[model samples]
Target chain A: MKKILLSFFVALAGFAAHAQETTLAPDQNPRYAESRDRYIKAQDQLLVNMNTTVQQTYKAYDWYEAKQERKLQRYNDRRERRLLRAQYGNFYSPYDNNYYSPYRYAPGFRRNGWRRGW
Target chain B: MKSIFLYATAAILLVTTACSRKVTRIDPVDTPDISGKWNNTDSRLTAEELTSQILTEKWIGDYVQAKGKKPVVIVGMVTNKSHEHIEAETFMKDLERSFITSSKIGLVQSGKKREELRAEKADQQTNASVSTMKKFGLENGADFILQGSINSIVDAYKRKKTVTYQVNLELTNIETNEVVWIGEKKIAKNVKN
Candidate 1:
């Protein structure tokens, strides 16, 4: 009887050790669960709205950048056409001893990575 | 007569077009985010985070248990180490307003304001009544100084840039020089050109 009782106690202890309890459970209260579900749905809707907004903003910004790039390209092309004379836009203005270019400083000199010609 | 009429029409057109600016008033609490830089929204959010986190920290409870009174805190320097010129003063002002009104911690005068207070008290010593004049030694010394830094990291590829700001604040005990509490608020912004 003592051996049986000791074996029963040992088996109980082993079972207790191996059978770990879990504390993860959804709220049982109806009010709490309702609020949680509402909060989750609202959060999901907010994320959807945010993603839509971010995508739109990114697209708009990209369009604006493309517009600016096109404007810059047009300006450069116009300047190139104006500069590419018979002398490859190397024509010096008679008013000053400077090339007829909008770029500051001499074409042979580089100032802040800006030069009409090198 | 024709030349005068042409000039008048041109003048009226120019004036009307020049003054065609449309102004729309917005709620200060909720405004549209433009340029995605640090603004009043960020300041308000940081202040809100600070109020909630500081009040719920273990240090507050510990201090209350030890002293039976709320700890006095003085707002100090908050350095802005960002790529953009972010004004930390606005954030500090928001925090100060929250701290004073929260009733969680006793707030004290700090920086130039404290110096000006002292100067006023000195002036009052000679000009004002004894009871009305504020005394210098009677002021509440701060138990902790709240200081922090606004640091940012920006990653740019072509026209899009992601700016991440880490605002770190620490409360240190004046006597022990031990950091009793630390709080951080991270705000990330994705800006595209």
Candidate 2:
């Protein structure tokens, strides 16, 4: 009985050694698998941080750009109108009621004399 | 009297047409900067110089040799903190274009565009045929991200002002957070009013 029990224990040890020689399931190596998972989680978090940073930076940038665009448009339009008025005297149109031009049809109004007034 | 009327008509016609807003097309290269603020030439030339500098750095070679592939890059935000309204997007696009044309690095979309791409993919998942639908989590992640700022300093006295714009860009490794390359381009203009 003792010899049979000893042989049975030896056989169990051999099976355990064989199992070790064979590839273990991922779950069997909890330490390595957990470390790997942690690494991946850290990496994913890093990437998420990176994306968030980029998005926030661009959000501010885009807001400023649009604001600047509107401001520039306003400035440019005003400047262009001022330039047009300077280059050519106030535009007069007969059909438009909203046309409030400084130069109305004066029978004797001289174009060159307007400069002399200044 | 007939000749006087004809001359009057001719003079009126000439006056009506000659002094109105006249637009003459000229080469953009020939277009001089009327306002000494940041302009297209500054953006284009800065991108060209920085792209060349970024590519020639040791980090690119190290990454290529270690990874056995070209580094994928995504251009992030370039904040414009200049005295004038500088469109940093144009400069960013110029940099992206130069990177692509160089064929030395891979480029990926960032910010809203990337979100748009992901949204499209999500839509495709439900709407498209099973065989034709794109898979999720298949994006080639960027290995490096380039971000920067455009800053300026202005010194003015009475009618004369000197504006100096400094464009500083840095490329950082996305994985390691290592700044691989840093570049700066300075453009200055003197304006007199």
Candidate 3:
């Protein structure tokens, strides 16, 4: 009976050793399922943060660009308006009788007067 | 002898415990510091910046003669060829809004405004019992159509990965298939265990 009990104990010890050898340590074990889940969560959070940052930066950029653009547009518009005014200011309608100045007629009339007196 | 064995066992246990306790310190999983001044290379506006740069170029500006006329633009499709599912619409909308707010372009809402005008005219004709209602059609077609695409490539190792994204855009004439403008942006990111 004593021999039988010793054999049984040895068998149990061998079985336990085999089990330990087959099993992996906690850290080394495949927690891929769990790690994958965590990774997905982390990725989602990162994406959200990235999107928010992008939006904010884009908004700020747009604001700055808009302000600068408005200034430039106003300046250009003013310059163009001034140019148009200068170029078209001396223009007159064809129907206007005073299209030419009266100085030329003054000289011609004087010559005609002298000829008439002669 | 029993005391010596006890001491030896304690010593072995202490050594094993110390070896097993390998201080991992979990130092907050080094995340990418997306906060600071990032280059336009890694930014979302890379494509837009490039496009704007192209637009501002003296040659393009001179050719377009768009100086006098506000840049009238129409947003078209943006195809995605990236591995990850990304919405191109969001970025396109941002660009459209930027153009509108900038006032650099006389943005005409495609069909929507014309429809509204037609409805108004129809209502007027119904009320007045007049056949002399003004017919409204495509009063304005877009001078330029903006189209683009997004593509990506990825490489990965054991808990380490790299992703690259590329965005390209083009402006084409409505009457002609000529590509009047071209723009591109690229971004790359690295992640590790």
Give the best candidate by DockQ: 2
How does model 1 score on DockQ?
0.02
Clashes of 2: 0
TM-score of each: 0.60, 0.60, 0.41
Worst 10 residues of 2 chain B by lDDT: B76-85
Residue by residue across A7-111, what tens digits does model 1's lDDT show?
999999988776633223465443555666787878634333210111111122344556678999999987786766432433555532235444435534666
Between prediction 2 and prediction 3, which has the larger TM-score?
Answer: 2
Which candidate has the top score in TM-score? 2
What would you estimate as the lDDT of candidate 3? 0.58
lDDT of 2 by residue, B98-141 (tens): 77888888998877677778899999999999999999988998
Instruction: State the lDDT of candidate 3 residue by residue for B1-193, as single tens digits.
Output: 9999999999999999988955554333343355222332244466366547544645345434745555566665566666555566555555666666665555555324444666787777667556756655635667777767767766655455566678787877654567877777777777553
lDDT, candidate 2, A45-106, per-residue tens: 44442322231111222333456679999999988877866544455345421234443333
Report the C-alpha lDDT of model 3 over A13-63, residue by residue, as the tens digit: 999998976676666646555765787879634333211112111122233
lDDT of each: 0.72, 0.74, 0.58
As a TM-score, model 1 comes out at 0.60
* Candidate 2 wrongly placed segments (more than 4 Å): A1-118, B1-12
In model 1, residue pairs whose N, Cα or C atoms come closer than 3 Å (at least 3 residues apart or on different chains), thus clashing, are none
Report each candidate's C-alpha RMSD, comma-separated, in the order given: 21.6, 14.3, 41.1
Poorest stretch of ten by lDDT in candidate 1 chain A: A50-59
Off by over 4 Å in 1: A1-118, B1-14
